[model samples]
Target: MTPEDLAPDVLTDAAAPIDPARVSDSLDHENTLKKDFVRRVRDCLEAGESDTVYDLVEPLHPADVADLFELLDADERPLLAKAISDLMGSEVFAELNDHVRELLVESLPAGTVADIAEQLDTDDAVAMLEDLDEHDQLAVLAEMEPEDRAAIETALSYPEESAGRLMSRDCVAVPEHMSVGDLIDFLREGHDLANEFWEVFIVDARHHPLGTCQLSWILRTPRHIALTDVMKRDQTLIPVLMDQEEVALRFQKYALISAAVIDEDGRLVGQITVDDVVHIIQEEAGEDVLLLSGAGEGDINEPIRESYLARVRWLIANLLTACLASFVIANFEGTIAKMVALATLMPIVAGIGGNAGTQTLAVTVRALATNQLTASNAWRAVRRELGIAVLNGATVAVVIGIAVSLIFGIPRLGAVIALAMLANIVIAGLAGVLVPLTLNRLKADPAISSSIFVTMTTDSMGFLVFLGLASISGLVG
Candidate 1:
């Protein structure tokens, strides 16, 4: 039966009544909800009791409701949605994970989806519509109020993940010619405005943002002062096409509370507040980390099919790279067979080197992401990694060398392995830093392919160094 078939009272009765104290404790004690709470919610949905489910879930904060939506099984979501139709507010939609929200919207009727999108801010409305199929998107847009539809359509015209797409259109902007008194009077005159704003952008006749005057400054300055006179001219005006990451960097670099988003002709369109930047910072940081591992997004709320697709391609690339390393190892098979001990000791060298390379790769990727490593200091950073590698190799060589010598009772063999260890590790350090740097130079996403290539280099080189050393030194008869 459909989700709508569920009766509200049945849902409430089926849901195990959770104590308010328990709910409070769950929220306070952990960043995520307990499984029992999720089970109860799920059971309520499964029982087809809409009223009971609504009563049980109605107390949750919007974010918590979003989290609950994410935690539910895909098949159960529509049922849950039907059970708590009234509770599904704009705040809940805002908090829902991108993938889950998209799924929920796609599952609902076009008119229902449009009704929800109309309630969201312009940026969020654009985001909600952007992911839908063209036909579905058009259908939903057609159902929205004309003004909101136009605003969203205007935002959608910009590139995805840009300031134009991310910034809310509901911002405060006033003509630069207005006096502080006029600005204050305008604010007091009760024009419907955004719920919050840190600064008011001063725009010219053509709508070009001339400067910005913070609310604090306007409140403290003399009422007779012209807004243009007091406003800071050197403001960080974000081009509508600027990427969200760059937008965050601008906010961070200038310590801006709010910045004006300008269109192609430098006309002020909207303002991006620090709150928006906070989400951008979080999303971009997480994206970088996941991309470094070739994990793609890595959101738990992601659909199974999408997650599988994201990771499978990376795994396939890794498998291919692994085979290349195997080919290198095959070339040294004779040496390994002659000295069985080589097989035992060989993995240690390669594994250690791989670990070392990974450590360097992680740091380098992070540095590049934060713009801490640049052309001016790239060589300096590379040199520093080289020096660190030398120290690490030396320290690890001494320990492994002595241990191998005592265990195998062969001093010369120990020396050969030790030398190999030193060489492989130094190579690991070099490859780790250089591979990503090279990828960056090639204009590739260094995070996506660097680890695979770096790992391959360390593993192949590690095996070759240890086995080649052993063979050349006659340690393997």
Candidate 2:
């Protein structure tokens, strides 16, 4: 009946809930540990207590160390990096955001940078080195071992952001003729292979990958069975020159844990793992979002000068577009003067249309990104959008029409505004979908300038429709 007696029964029940207060306390304790760890390290640095900082940071995971680096100020990052120089391993480098890693690499001596690169896999080493300045890159490359340097140089030669750069050269590969017993002996004989792999690729005499043998099959299959017998032939083989985004799509489409990377000669050169594809997916997804806003790689760690350079051009382009809308408004100055209400009500129509256009534009851009919208389905998508636009126009027209009539006590004015709203909304929807699609056809990035053109269309059309209708209907004195 007591708490101690109930503890045994609670432990036996798998689904028993823990105390809410206890759970909260545990979370708070973990958070406190993180904060205290950071503070103690900071205090150690300030007080010239080097050993204390080193001891405090020693137990943290690489990812947590990376987080701690980010939590520090710009001035503190270098200090922490210097303090935990030994602890700054390949895993910590892998966890860092690109901008932060670039900054850290730039700050470190070239020799020190090379030392870190040597400890990393080929893919991670290439990632760390590629962002450096040409001179710094050369200096670091000079310090690397001859073979490691050659492998990185070969990967770099294949083009930036390609599968060649993304793939690691370390992988378990076997000749297709090997039996399961032979494969197991090969694995057991302490071959220098990747630290982790989900599958072993079976290659032909010319080093061309023929098929794959999953680890599960290797473990369960009879030892006398040939690898060719158990291997799955329908494996995805990525071309070394393929874009990283395309590589990620292949992984996603095929649901693969690992895929072979083949060179021009169809020879297996490397392998792309799921972990690498996960990073590519995240990078590509974020890159698309930033590109949509005309913001290039909008990382918080980006240098102020670089951030300004990236964003200012977009702002300037927006300014030019705004002037075009202003010019359209100026042409209707006479109409605005004749009816003050025209000036007041005109903005509502244009503003609503711009918003509606942005909504459709965003959807279109996303569709293009995910490969859901292709030339084959373009017309069908456009038609679907047009139909939705018509429905939206009708629904909005009725509400705005009735409201305007009641507010102004002028049925004719209400009717004119309502028709204008309906027309603008329909145009907004059409322009939204068409502009991005057209840009995509022209081989331009659909997200980059779609918003600017879509806004221009909605604004110009909204103004022209409202003013022309008011002038034609004799609403303007």
Candidate 3:
């Protein structure tokens, strides 16, 4: 209809003042999902104005709304979910924090959860159910429609954190024999296609993925060309049993938006999208860092008892290592008694060495994780670390040497400590690189317990070298 034929009051309706309280500022660059928005939603909920709470949150992105769920107190999550039941779509659940999502899911009925699972991509649906107990999972699955139930059940049968568990079952795959025109027409006529796909997998008669045809290519190339002719032959296929972290690395290295996931027989079963890889990358990166500190998953929403259990066990292990350093100190009691300056300067040696080791350890673990450090080239990595250690040792030794000489007015003491510092720092670098590599060779995670062992080595050796030199040189006595 022409503008004149439209409703006479359209302009007036368009110009109506926005309700300040109901306005969604989610799109405004400045109006981020901060504490103020959270407080307003909380206030609205507390006042029993569930509709107002919904209005306040309706403008947020699914990820932002998920963040809002995290921002809420645990008790309030269910209340807010009740208030925004219609708004709690699959996207919101997909983006929700694992802990928060589980809490909400547990509060939901089996049928409702099944419905949500049905609405989500297979990977996300699997993630939602992955944490549930066998009984709870079965209940949810029983409530689901048969097709979705079968897809989820098959995915759950794979080991957790594997490509099979991470991939989306709803992929767009077509026979290789079709022409580009035929593929285009089929895609246009298909009603049950995946909501999101970057490329269409070209498959053989046996349903084995042969290659991929990117959407950009499909749209640009002439329709008369055979699908196999225009499709890229060099496509990365993810093994179903491959670890999720490896899956992410492959995505990063290959710059892939989506890759076909294959079974043992090399038959295409599902696809892993880049969006899921992003989550896996973030999880693995954080997991390694927390593991280095002996901290278990280090999730804030973790129960107090669970957090304590994860952290305290490591602290106890650290205590045992601390005693080994103490044993070295006890052996040098006479040396410290003769010159109290030895007592004052020993900790500086140990502390700095520990820090140096930690720096190297972090780098080594990351390189190993990214496949940058491997058996054939490990020696090269070691030599590079040794060079860095030498530079670090020289810098630290010179500064500490000058300070000791000036403060103690004993050149021999300074010389003893300077040489000791150099020895310990070089030892730190060696231990840092060697420990993680050893752990990796043993098929253990390099990040886990590496920090503790590295600290112990630095501390014990720091005490041994400094005290041994001080005793032998007769600088203190």
All-Cα superposition RMSD per candidate = 3.7, 9.2, 7.0
Between the candidate structures 1 and 2, which one is better when assessed by TM-score? 1
lDDT of 1 by residue, 175-273 (tens): 877999999999998567877888888888999988888889999999999988899999888999998988998898889888899888999888888
Candidate 2 residue pairs in clash (backbone atoms < 3 Å): none
Q: What's the lDDT for all of these models?
A: 0.84, 0.83, 0.88
- Model 2 ranges off by over 4 Å: 1-40
Considering only N, C-alpha and C atoms within 3 Å, which residue pairs clash in candidate 3? none
For residue 408, give model 1's deviation from the true position in Å: 0.8
Q: How many Å off is the CA of 365 in candidate 2? A: 1.2
Q: Which stretches of candidate 1 lie over 4 Å from their true place?
A: 1-28
| Local accuracy of candidate 2 as per-residue lDDT tens digits, 1-477 | 121211111111112334555334323355433565567677887786757676666656567668777777777777777666667777788788777888878787666677778778899999998988899899989988998999999998989999999999988888988999999888988657777888999999999999999899999999999999999999788999998988988888888888999999999999999999998999888887797788878888888999899889988988888888889889989988988888888888999888888888888988887788999999998998888888888888788889888988878788888899999999999998999999999999888888888888888899889888988998866
Alpha carbon lDDT of residue 44, candidate 2? 82
Query: In candidate 3, what are the lDDT values of residues 391-422, reduced to their tens digit?
Result: 99988999899889999898888888898999
Give the Å error, residue 387, model 3: 2.0
